[model samples]
Target: MQKVIIFTDGACKGNPGRGGIGYYLISDAGKTLKGSKSYLRTTSSRMELMAAIEALRLLKFPCKVELYTDSRYLADSVNKGWLNTWLASPFFLNRKNEDLWRRLANEMQKHQVSIHWVKGHSEQAQHRLVDRLASRACNSPKPLIDPGYFFKI
Candidate 1:
């Protein structure tokens, strides 16, 4: 399987304000892809999860993915078995960011994924780059509407 490494970050102007998600993807074949999108209104957690979902969605075929994020909510959900517990539970309506979680879960099944947690604003260049990208995205003038945040879908 093709091996790929992804670094993701999310930035929010305020807790429930403008948010953005960023991701950087590098493949074993020396290919690179990067993206950032700003949402009109959302939470940091939603942006974090969206980063992973968007990154995985970009892949054209199934591959081995090493997804790195600075958010504990994102990393711990997968690493600490919280995602499986949530999926198995019937109380999905009570879960926060259930829409993004379900969307992320669907994208994850398309590949072999491993989620890694990294310290925010770390010395790593890739991590810092993604951080900057996310920050910039949130500050963009033309932000897109976040339906999930507005409609709670």
Candidate 2:
């Protein structure tokens, strides 16, 4: 199976405001893929989850994956099995970003994935790259609103 290293990041102007998601994927062969998306009404956690969701979605087939992210909410949710608990919950009520979480769960089932946490605003090049990608999305002239998500506040 192919191996991939993925780094994800998200940014938001306000807790419930303009947001963006970014991801950087590196294949075992050294190919690098990067992308970003912006949303007019979203939260940073949503963007972060979206980045991870998109990263896994890009995989053509199941493979070994090492995912890195700065968002503890995302990293911990998966790594600590909180997401599974939520999935096992009755109706998943009161869970934030349930839609994105469902998408993430679907994408994850397609591959072998592991989540890692990193410190944001660090000097790491890949980290900074994703950070820049997400930041740029927030600065786009006309970022489209994400139909998959909305801000509650």
Candidate 3:
């Protein structure tokens, strides 16, 4: 099976403020496929989840994907299996970032995806690229949208 490597990162000006998500897609042979970054007026967690979701959507074909991100909340929640239990519950009963989590879980069901936790601002080339892209997205003049619909003040 063919493999795709994805590097993702999210940044927020504040814990619950303007944010941006970034990703870099590369083939197993080290060919750069694509790069994307998006801005949002939401929390770091939402951007983190959005980064993964957007990366998956960017893929044109089904392939084995290894997605790397700096957020342990995102990586562990999906990879360590908290998504299933969160989905089974209704009314959002104390769940955090429900909208982003649900969106991520839905997108995850559509592809062969794996999550890897990487150290932020490390020596990884792709990770640095994602950071630069995310910073650009955050500083760009693009209008931001609220991604965390379920998040209360």
TM-score of 3: 0.87
Model 1 lDDT tens row, 15-120: 7899998999999999999999999888888899988999999999999999999999999999999998999999976798888888999999999999999999
lDDT leaderboard ranking:
1, 2, 3
TM-score of each: 0.97, 0.94, 0.87
The global C-alpha lDDT for each of the candidates, from Candidate 1 onward, is 0.92, 0.89, 0.78
lDDT of 2 by residue, 8-46 (tens): 999988877788888999999999999998888777888
Q: What C-alpha lDDT, on a 0 to 100 scale, does residue 13 get in candidate 2?
A: 87
Provide the lDDT at 143 for model 1.
93
List the candidate 3 regions with Cα displacement exceeding 4 Å.
Answer: 29-31, 91-94, 149-153
TM-score pick, better of 2 and 3:
2
Model 2 bad stretches (over 4 Å)? 148-153
> Arrange candidates by TM-score, highest first: which order?
1, 2, 3
Distance from true position, residue 147, model 1, in Å? 1.1
Name the best candidate (by lDDT). 1
